[model samples]
Structures are given as C-alpha cells and as structure tokens.
Target chain A: MSTDSDAVTAAVLVIGDEILSGRTKDKNIGTIADYLTAIGIDLREVRIVPDVAEAIVEAVNQLRARHTYLFTTGGIGPTHDDITADCVAEAFGVGIDVDPRARAMLLERHKPEDLNAARLRMARIPDGAALIPNPISKAPGFHIGNVFVMAGVPAIMQAMLDQIGPGLARGAAMLSETIEARGLPEGTYAGRLGEIAGRHPGVSVGSYPSMTQTGFQNRIVVRSKDAAALGAARAEIEALVAELSA
Target chain B: MSTDSDAVTAAVLVIGDEILSGRTKDKNIGTIADYLTAIGIDLREVRIVPDVAEAIVEAVNQLRARHTYLFTTGGIGPTHDDITADCVAEAFGVGIDVDPRARAMLLERHKPEDLNAARLRMARIPDGAALIPNPISKAPGFHIGNVFVMAGVPAIMQAMLDQIGPGLARGAAMLSETIEARGLPEGTYAGRLGEIAGRHPGVSVGSYPSMTQTGFQNRIVVRSKDAAALGAARAEIEALVAELSA
Candidate 1:
C-alpha cells in the first residue's frame, strides 16, 4: 500500500518460468523500481510467478487489489506459455482479441506476409485496454485498469516504460541523501544511529554494507519527501558518523 | 504454495531500503533461487520490504505461514536500521538476546575489547534459533522454525547457506534441459509447442528469447524432477526446433 496520501504505490508481477527456475536473473524489478521511484511511485512488492495462467491471474488480482498500480513483465510473447494477456483479461473479467492498432504497429516492422499466426500473437490485446507502444519491438504492451503488461526483455520493457512515463499519475517524490561512514563498521555507531532514527520519524534510515576492492564499505541513507526534514536527518547522521569515526 | 506433495516450497523476504530505492541491486535473490532450486525447493514468492519493524514483522509472519521455508536477506547488521533480528523475534513471539556462542563467533574476528555495543548487535538472536555460521564476516545468521535470517552481503549469505545446506530438508531435485530454436520467433512454433507441453503432464515447457549479434534467438526449456519425462519432453522440443528451422 502507498504509505502517505501523496504516495503512489506499485507492485511488479514478473511472469516467466525462466525466472522461477533461476535460468534468468530478473533485471526488470530493479530497473522498474528505479524508474517508478524517480516518478514518485513507491514500489511496494515484487512477485515472480511462472508462465502459468492461473498463477498469473491470481497474482494480478491479488496485487492490483492492494496497490495503486501493478506492472507485469514476461509471458506476453508468442510462445504457448505466453499467457499473460489472456490471464490478465480473465482477472478483469474482459474478453481479448487481436487489436487492429497493435496489428498495425507490428506491420511497421514486419511485412504483411511476415505477419504470420505466430507473429500476430503479439497483437492480441485485452478488451478495453490501451496500447503501450514498444519502440524497439513492434509488439505493443497494454494498460488495462491499473495493470500494465509489458514485454520481459529488458530493452523492450524499458522502451515501453519511456513511452508510458509521461502519462503516469506520479506522487510527491521521495528525496534521499547518503553519507558514507568511511572505515567505520556498522557496529561502531549502530546503537546511537537507532536512537537518531527514533528521533526523526519523518525520515527512514538504513545502513548498508558492501564489499569493495579494498575492504568493506558502509553507507547510511536518510529518505523522506520533505527536503528540509531530510536535510536535518542527513546532517544528524553525518554528525553521528563523524562522532563515531573520531 | 507448493503444487505437489513432494515439492518443498519457499518464499524470500528481502528487507532493506537500498533495494527498494534501487541504490543497491540485489544479487541475493537470484543466488538463493538457484541454490534452492538445485536443492529441490520451489521458491514460490518473493517480497521486498523496508527496514520498518512493522513491515518486516508483517511480511515474515505472512510468508512463514504460507511456505515451507522462508529465507530473508538484509537488516542483520550492527546498525540501528539493522533490526531484522528483533523483528523476527517479534514475529515468532520469542525473546532475543546476545548468545554466548554467537559472541564467541564474533570474537574470532574482533578483539574482546573491540566487541563494542554496535558489533555486539550481531549476536542477538531469537530464542530457540540455531546459528548459521558466516565464515567470511563472522556475523552468524540464524535458523528458527521455518525461517532463516541471513546477511545482505552476497558473499556472507552464500557462505552461511553453504554452512547450513546439509541440515536442510530437501525434496527430489528438479532437473532441466534447454533446446535452442535458431532463427525462429516464439509465435512460429508456439501453438505446436503448447500441444507438446500438454502431452507431457510431468514436465514444464518454457520459451525464452534473447537478442544476439544476428537477431532474436529463442530457447525452449523442459523441466521436471522425473529424468525420463524431462528427457522425453526435451527430445520433443529439439525436434520441434529442428522442424521450425527447416
């Protein structure tokens, strides 16, 4: 759910057996999370379901009910297992057919003879859904209700996102500031850091550790929609890190 | 939920703000999915929650109840935001404290005088949980009930999993084979591919597309625990791809 009234929340439903079986490492979740955050939509949850219709339909219905928007990737291809469009239609209780507009979009890349039955599978759209144009691939994605069904391939999904970006209903952007705690391990400053977080309810604080060529690095981040409040929290965290480092 | 009685199911709870804000790309999910699949656990769902205690507690309780095993990554550090241990304790209605064994584990890396309050935070574990040793960092993960709380660092998490691997309850391994369908769009063979997949009740068939130097390359994968069934399905797909290529 969206945390604040001004926050637009979203959930990603990645549909593919390749992902569940670990044959494919999903790049879309991180990519879409970054994109949505830029436009003030909080990515609340991400679920990866196999290329099964019942699984896709169940996930779509459940996620769409809880979030402001649901974005699905994969399973919209021309393969037998590519059942996302049909499943989405069933979820919304709508009929689906090959849209002339989507077929026309495909024709931009493929010749009339090349638009065989297999290729035409990309043109099917759920009834009452608008097309999300794919610039890289002619196969268009679609937006029905709060669900946006996009291709699984990272390049095509990105292009579709760029196409639909301007039309999205964005909320207040969450501003974030990061402070590196240089060589200090998290344990050195963790106690007071929690107290500092407790003092600032407006901001969310987190500490992350990463391995680098030299050694480990810890970063503390403060995030909030309020710039002034975020600034105050950032300053406090910086001070805390300084005190501990000294 | 696990589809078959013989299948062991799991859910991943990724807790961190770095992932949600897209500051850090999570490598743990793919690593764990591949690991679990190899060991015969079906990862049914994945949820990424923030550092908030309520969010962690809610997700932990919900997922732990739904799946046979729950693996959590992130928030087990020496910082205040690293409250996963506490949240996990709350989820299970248990008391938590710094166990002597865990402190001893930390002492292997840190001098006794250096084990300050912050570093000691890593030692606090829920009641009745067994430590999952971390060889890289010496910060131990814990397994309690059906839940495993692990580090966010990929290296440490992997090491901990290696340490705890032998103790896990494993089902029959799910095996897979891939067939390359050269120079074909998924739609060209999708209809017949579905028919073949329907014929094989024991195996799952999936089509995946990738962009290469030439153009689009498609691969069909057949997966199942039964080797003979998987072999039969794989043979059928290879034949289909050859026919389509011809």
Candidate 2:
C-alpha cells in the first residue's frame, strides 16, 4: 500500500578485525548512518563483523535480507585478509573472479608491469554485480542484489558512496528539531515529556541528558518524516521545558 | 572445558534513537570495545537499536544468547524514553519495579525531597540484579544474568564499566604488537603477508595501509592471547618487511 511515509531502509556491515580488536575506532558507521539518513533511507542496523569468512558471510546474508538495502565496507583491498569480495560471493551463492571492469579501474592507477598478484586482488568482483567507481583509488567496489560492497578505507568508501548515492531510490526526508533545557534535570520533566510524546504520537521524541562541567543539561530531540508534525512536537516540548522552568 | 584460550566475549547494545538517526555518533560502543578487549573479553557484535521497546528487548535477548556477555548502554535514565530496565526485565521474563537497592544508591546523591517521580525512574531495575556502582553520578547500573545495563552518557558508562570489569570473569589477555612498514604499498607485500599469516595460524596478523602526505604507509599488527606466539609472529613480520625493503 502506498503511504505518505518513504520507507527505504538500510543496514551497514563493517567487516574488520581491527575494529573488533579495539585497534581501530569505527568512523564509517556514523558516516554511513548520516549519509543514509540524509538520502531518506532508514538505517535500521549497523553490524561489525570480524575478517573471518563465516562471520562476514553470515552478516552479509542476514542484514541484506532484512533491510531494503545493505552497504558493506572494508576487506576489499589487496591483502589476503581483505576477503570481503569472496565472502559476498559465498553469501549469495555466486562465482567471483577478477572482474575486467574492476581490473580496468585498477589499471588506470598501476602500470601493467606493476599490477602484481597482490595488487590484482583488488580487481576481484562477484558475478552479476555493477562496479561503484572509486575516483581517488584505482580499486572499485561493487553492488550485487540490494547489497553494495565498498572499501574499509574511509576515503575510498566515501568516494564510492558519492558515486552511488545519486542513483539510489530515496524517500521523504526525515526532519528533526531540538529543544534545549538549560540546567534542567531530565528527571524534573521526564513525566511531562512522556505525556507530550504520547499526545504527539507520530513524532519520536527523545530526552538526552549531558553532564556538563556546570551541571546536567537536557536536550529533547523530536524527529519525524513529517516536518509539520516534528515542528508541532518541538513546540510542545519547548512549552513543557518553559513550564518546568517556571 | 575452559582452557588457556581466551573465551570471554561481549556484545554492546546501544539503545537510543539519537544514534540511529545519526544525531549522536555513538562513543560508548568504542569505549566498551576497548575496555572489553583490554580485559581479555573479545567484543564481537555491536548493535545499535532505537529507543523502541521491542527493539531493545529483541537485541538484549539475541546478543546475550550469542556472546558470552552482553553490555547495553543507554535508556536507563529518568525519562519515559528510558525503558532499558523495563525492556530488560521483559526480555528475561521477570517483573521490574523501583529496586530498593538502586533507590538506596540514588539516595546517596539526591535528597529524599528532591527525589521526584521522574528522578526516581532511574531506580527501576529488573527482579534480581547486582547493582553496578556509578561513582560519577549516584544512578547505579545493574547486572542481571550476563547483561550489564548502564547509562548512555559516556562518562557515567565508563565509570560503571570500571566498577564491573574487575568482578567479571577474565580470560587470557589478548595482546598485540604493531610493526610499521615505511612507504610500503600493501600490493607489494600483501601476498607475502598472507603467507606469513597462514604459517603462524595462531596469531592474527593484519596489514593496514594508510595514505599520508608522503606516500602509502603500511602497518602490520599481530595479535594473540599467547605472548610467545605473538612475539614469534611479530618477528616473522619484521623479517618479511626487511626482506621486502631489500
């Protein structure tokens, strides 16, 4: 049934042992999250699996099946540990080889003599997939079914996203408004906030308390796909905060 | 059944709409990841779910069953949106209310008169749980089975983690050593590195390439619970990099 809401959804699968080992702090999850939200896609889940084939395969299959789209980053490099392309193939029951399109992309950067076996690893792509160009690097990412695989490298991954973002289906943009409560404890106004949220059921209102150097400051963020509804809820929240102050 | 193998594993459930909407970049997931890894607990899957009760309940149930332990951050606050404790109880099929032990901890920071209905919401805990001391603020976290629920606030979450880390079961420490390869492209050394990784088998060695202003610099990181195995792998990696230079 066609409804007012745009329902394009996505999940991010970050494949890396570095993240799980605490050697790397994930910057890609938030990057992808912000990008998806901006493009009117609901990013429902973000999962980080290790470099292990089973872990990668299982996550790729699970996330792709549940969401409208799945985006994976990392493990598509030249290293042996970079096995995301192979894993994607196994997950979808497809064959994988050095894709000519991907190879051509790599050849743009490296001379024929320089394209060693290790370097050529970046050219492998799963069958029946379209290449997502990486302008900065010669390596290319690919998309098969609803899943798009990109590099773990942030710069390369971002370039790939820029290439693909314009082509994806988008829904109505989700809008958000924030109301600040200066020096107000959430506990002081939580009950009323709940009531306000219930009254404006369409908008999802959240209360976040940050313990600043001065004291606990509260910020209520109201979000919805409908801008008018979000504004109405924000107004109610502002009124509630003002009343609590008095 | 429990040998020298480091078996302690953990998953983090970030409960908030702020994160999913990309309003707040999750700082707790990485914080917990570092903490768990440092203490010999392998932090596996990390999940970010909205403040929706069903999402929280499902994540808590699923992650706890899969990992050796599950740590959930956020929603254990004073607001109506703060339903982690309630959802946790529902997940475990137990009744929840304002726990006396948790109330006593809150009383340490708040005067009885100031303990308003909203403020007291922080005292709600599942039927049976050991209170996790929160030194930063008086709101105590709780341990119900393998799940530890804490505040979403980074500072307070860190405090709660510190309180509980020592009490939990720890396995052999997962140690790592890093060796840098100056200006070495992964393509030049990926195949050999893969061979070295295969030979070691015990320690996990990963080759990461970072693009700096100078050129592409690679770092090989070797990790294992066994110190001797890790050292040996590190030596092999160092030798390989030296040979590549030659």
Candidate 3:
C-alpha cells in the first residue's frame, strides 16, 4: 500500500576535520536544510565526521540505509584530506575511478596543462554513479545509489543542489507559524504552552527564548502539515501570550 | 599509561523535528561548538536528527561508541513528543525512571504539588545515570554511560555544560592563531598558504574569506598542539598576508 506521496526524506553527512577542530564554522548545514525544505524534502539527519575514512564510511552507510536520499558535503575537494568519495564508494561496495565523464567536465574549464595531479583528484568518481552538475565550477559532484556527494563550499553546494534537487522525490510540504512574546521568561508561559501543544496532537510546538539588548523575548513556533490545525494552535498560543503579557 | 593530559572529546547530537523541517534555524550547534572548544574539550562531530526514536537511537549509539563524551541537546523537555530520554534509554538498553537525584533537584525550584505528570517527564533518567547539575533550573541533565542528555535551550544548555565540563577528561589543549589579510581573495594566497601548510605538518591551516561593507577579508587560522610550530606558522602566515596585501 504505497501512498505515492511526494514527501522526500534526506540526511546530510559533513566530512571534515577542520569543522571538528573549531577552525571552521560550518555554513552548509543551514543552507542545505533551508533549500531541501523549500523543495519539499525533509532533511532528517546531519552528521559531521572528520576526514577519516572509517568515520565517513560508517556515516555514509548508516544514513544511506535510513533515508530515501543522502547528501554529503566536504572531503570531495582536491586536497589530500578529501577522502569522502573513496569512503562513499567503499560504503556502497563499489569501485572508484577517474571517470571519463567527470574528467571531461574538469577538462572543459581547466586546460590539460593546468590539470595537475591535485586538480585531477576532483575528477574521480565511484563507478556506476551519475554526475551532479556544479554551476560554479566545471568539476561536478556525483550520485551513486541514493547518495549525492557535493562540495563543501556554500556557493558550489548550492549550485549543485539547484541542479539535482528538482528531480528528487518529495513529500507533503511542512508548514510553520511563529508567535512572538515580548519580555516574557520561558518559565512564565511554558506550562500553558505545553497544555495547548498536548491538546493539538498533530502540531509540534517549540519555544525559543531570545535575548535582546532591551530584554528577553520568547518566540513560539507551531508547525504541522495541516494548515487549519496550525492556525488553531497559533491562535491558542497568541491568546496565551496575551494573557501572560497582561 | 594515563597521559595526565586532560583529553576531553565531545560529540553533539541535535534532536528536533523543527531542524529537520527547516522551521527553526539551529543556534545550538555553533553555541555548543564554541562552548566545548572554550572549555578545552575537542568538539568532534555534530549530528542533527529528527525527533524519531530509531534515528535518535542510531546516532546515540554511534557517537557514544566513537567519542569520550556525548552531549545531546533538544527533545528533553516536558512535551509528549520530547522522546530523547526514552530513546537514549533504549539505545543503552536500560530502564528509565524518575530519578531521585534529578527529582530532588527539580523539587528545589518546583513546588511539590506543581510537579505534575507533565513536569515529572523531565526527571526521567536512564538506569545508573548521574545527574548533570543545571544552574538555571534545578532539573538536572543525566549522564548514562558517556552520553549526557541536555536541554535544547541555548541558555539552559550552556548552564548544564558549565556544570559538567570541569569533571570530564580533556586532551592536550587545542591552540589557534589568526593572521588577517585585507581585501584578499582566497585564490590569490591559496597556493602559497598550501605550500606553508605543507612545510608545517603539525599545523592545520584554513583560510576563511569574509565580505564586509568596506571590502573582502581573509583570515588564516593556524592551529596545532606544539607551541613552537604554531608560532612559526603564525609568523609565516602574517608575512604571507602582508605580501598578498602589498
């Protein structure tokens, strides 16, 4: 009994030692999450592993097994530490080679003379994988099985996602509404909010307490696939916040 | 042989349906990363998973196996959907109960009558877990094996981290130094920086490019355990930035 729904589910695996060391603040996770949601694909999980092969392999295998699609960033660059492609290949029980199609794409931008050993490393792809077009650079990311490997750079990753996201399977669109409460401590409204949230089984409510230069602010978010349910929950939340403020 | 060097390594698992749906932007990942780094623990891997039992269980098991410590934020609140504590118990193959230690801490702030069935949900802990003191609210986070379950609220999570950080084992402190380049594109200095990085095997060099209202800026970070190597690398990086700017 397949629902044949458009809902697409995916997970992201970020590969880099630099992220772990706190040397780099990852920007791709948020961007991808936003983009995937816009395309109606739920980004279910994100994992950041070092450039180590075993970690990458384990994450790749586990995420791939769980999600309908998997998107991996980093470790596909030309540097020596870029081992994600190899690890992904190993995880999928496939072989990797400098694919003629990938090499052709690389050769389109860089001259054969400029394509040094380091640059050539970017052309390697797992066997039986299709290329994910990269608009920023000629060197393309590739898709093997259900896994799509893309660059770590935000711009490049965005471009690759633009090329591949449209073709992926997607589910029902998730909807969200936010209600703002001024100068409210979370403790003041947490109980009533919990009651309202519990009453609405389909809606998921989150309380975010933000600090401004002036004072503390709480933003409550109610999200659900059912628009009417979301509206009802939002109304309750607004009423509760008004009562608390009064 | 205990190296006497405190070696603290942590992996962060972010649990929330909002993150997966892209309804909420994650502020907790960066905050926890910065906190762990400042407290002298190597913040290794970060995984963001949906509020699903199987997904949470898989991530908890994998990360707990790999890291010396594990910190999970989100899904530990009083809501029915906040299933992190239960999922964690299943992952560890242990029973969960309203732990006395955690309930005692909660009792200090919450009135005995006010500790309703919903409020009591936060006190659930895995078998044989120790409470991690929470300064903001007396309801403490509990540690079962290496996994320390914490709240998703940035302020509350920070408070719990402050309490538990000192007791954890830490590795040799990771040190970093920065050299700033004015109005430099990464490509301009990429080759030279790669050469310098090659020269110093111990130092991990990363070039971060930022755009300001004025112009572009590139910050080169040199990180290593060895003080002498780091100093040398910093000098070379400064000189390189100067040369590039000139």
Task: Return the top candidate by lDDT.
Answer: 1
DockQ of each: 0.59, 0.59, 0.32
- TM-score of model number 1: 0.94
Error of 2 at B60 (Å): 1.5
Residues B23-109 of candidate 3 have per-residue lDDT tens digits of 667777777777676666777689898777888998899889978889999887665567899999999999998988888887998
RMSD of 3: 4.7
How close is each model in CA RMSD to the real structure? 2.2, 2.4, 4.7
Docking quality category of candidate 1 according to DockQ thresholds: medium
lDDT per residue, candidate 1, A53-154, as tens digits? Answer: 787888899999989999999988877778889999999999999999999999998889878776778898999999998887789999999999999999
lDDT of 1 at B135: 85
Once fitted onto the true fold, the runs of candidate 3 whose alpha carbons sit more than 4 angstroms away are: A1-7, A179-202, A205-216, A228-246, B1-8, B38-40, B89-116, B125-128, B177-223, B227-246
- Please count the clashing residue pairs in each candidate, in the order shown: 1, 1, 12
Model 1's chain A TM-score stands at 0.96
lDDT of 1 at B73: 94
The local distance difference test score of each candidate is: 0.86, 0.85, 0.78
**Candidate 2 residues B88-194, lDDT tens each?**
99999999888888888889988898898888888988898888988887898899999999999999999998888888898788888899987877888888888
TM-score, one value per model: 0.94, 0.96, 0.80
lDDT of 2: 0.85
Model 2: CA > 4 A from native: A1-6, B1-6
> What local lDDT score does residue A63 receive in model 2, on the 0 to 100 scale?
89
Return the clash pairs for model 1, or none.
A187-B118
The model with the greater lDDT, 1 or 2, is 1
